[model samples]
Target chain A: MRGFLVLRVVAKLLMPFMLLFALYVQFHGDFSPGGGFQAGVIFAATVIFYALIFGLPAARQLVPEALVETMVALGVLVYAGVGVAGLLLGGNYLDYFVLAHSPVHGQERGIFWVEVGVAITVSGVMLKIFYMFAGRQRSAEDE
Target chain B: MAALTLGIALQRNLYAVVVLSGVYSFLMATALVALDAVDVAMTEASVGAGVSTVLLLGALYLCGGEEAKPLTRPWLPLVIALVIAGALVYGTLGLPAFSDPMAPIHTHVVPRYLHDALKETGVPNVVTAVLASYRGYDTLGETTVVFTAGAGVIALLRRIRRRKDGEQEAP
Candidate 1:
């Protein structure tokens, strides 16, 4: 596989486009038929594709396990923080109306941040699962 | 689709089953698109077809490529499945027709959500407004679940790596 020139070349060429599409899906979600979940999976798929072509170690180097774990926790914190911000601002839990000067702008801003949180958590979870399963088999074979 | 299901059911090869499952997910996504659930279709296509297939293939690498023979007789499980299927079919008989305007859902808070979503939330996508604004708590919970799952996997797998490192150090 390391010597497979065609696969290496094609995967390198396609990875950037896949990532760009994932970002597009993430940002355009409010207007389109995609959102955090779909975008997260697309992002994870790009990493998985990279892992397939370049090997697990390379993928691990690109996104270490510690960072992935942080992403998972950070995303939840971001989401909960937004809710607490609402509470601190004299609104109910998870309330977005009080997030800005205008209720509508506040809602939009809250939703956008919430979607970002969801995307990060979803991608982290997907990558964690992939790394777990893939790493387990490799370690098992080593023994 | 029926043929694909039959082929999946009849096949003993786990690899073939994984491939067929991916195909089935793609078909399900197509069906969702036809039903005007584009968001759900996108999710199905990405999670079901892309990620799930890769995960299953990774799992298959660790497990046997072929499914093992069942230890017990199949008739009792078959009867249970048929009974549940029959009950599900019977339950559907009491449901409203497709796109029934007078349905309970259509008559409920959905109408309000649809009418005032844009005005109140300033989000043009009603689904987004409802999911992120109206039901923000639920979305937060869902994100927490994803976080917990990742944490749980790390807890489970990290111990193995720690043990391996200890073993190497001892040797």
Candidate 2:
């Protein structure tokens, strides 16, 4: 793959656009067809493409294992924490009505944050699966 | 799509199977779009075609690319599969017709969601409102499951690295 100049150039050109589309899907989900789940997979796909073109080590270096692990936990915490916030604000568990000054605004704010959390967790899961499979091959070759 | 599935089943090469699976997923996504399930289509395209294909290819690399031969006869499994298919077809006879306005699902809670979703969630997208606010608890549970799966894979794979290092140190 390294010897293929055309492949390298095409990958370099495509990576940024792929990432941008993922972010678009993540943010525009409220108004559009995509949501956290789709956005997260798209995000992971960009990184996987990088791994395919430049090798797994390069992709791992770009997104470290520790960071990916932390993302998995942090996303869940963010989601749970939002529910707790609702409860503390004199609303039912997972209620979005009390998240802001007005009920409608609160619902909007809460849904946005929850979707963000979902996107994070989904991407982390995807990257973790990729890392496990790709790392196994590398380790086997080394042994 | 049926042709692709047949090709996948007939192919002995795991690599071809994985590739055909991706193609099947893409076709399914197109079918979902045709049914006006755009969100589901997007998910299918991404997770099924993108992530699953890469993961399968990686697995093929770690294992062998050729599928193993089955030791037993296939007739019994084929009979069981046909019976299950027949049962499923029989079961569909009891289901409401497609797009039936008076169906149980349409008459149950959908009206409220459709009428009140905008006022309730402040989100124009009813799908997102339903998924994030109406069914927040279920979404939370799904996120937890994803997190747990990731953690489980890390635990399983990282242990091998630790054990290998410990063996080297002991020697």
What residue runs in model 1 are displaced by over 4 Å at the alpha carbon? B160-171
Per-residue CA lDDT of model 2 for A63-130, tens digit only, reads 99888888888888889989999999999989989999999999999999999899899998999889
Question: Quick one: best TM-score, which candidate?
Answer: 2
lDDT tens readout by residue for model 1, A33-140: 777878888999999999989999999999998988788888888888888998999999888999999998989888888888899899999998999999988888
Estimate the TM-score for candidate 1. 0.94
Q: What is the TM-score of chain B in candidate 1?
A: 0.91
DockQ per candidate, 2 decimals = 0.78, 0.87
Best by the lDDT measure: 2
Chain A TM-score for each candidate, in the given order? 0.96, 0.97
Please give the C-alpha DockQ score of model 1.
0.78
Q: For this target, which candidate reaches the highest DockQ against the unseen true structure?
A: 2
Using all chains and alpha carbons, the TM-scores for the candidates as numbered come to 0.94, 0.95
RMSD of each: 2.4, 2.0
lDDT of each model, Cα atoms only? 0.90, 0.92
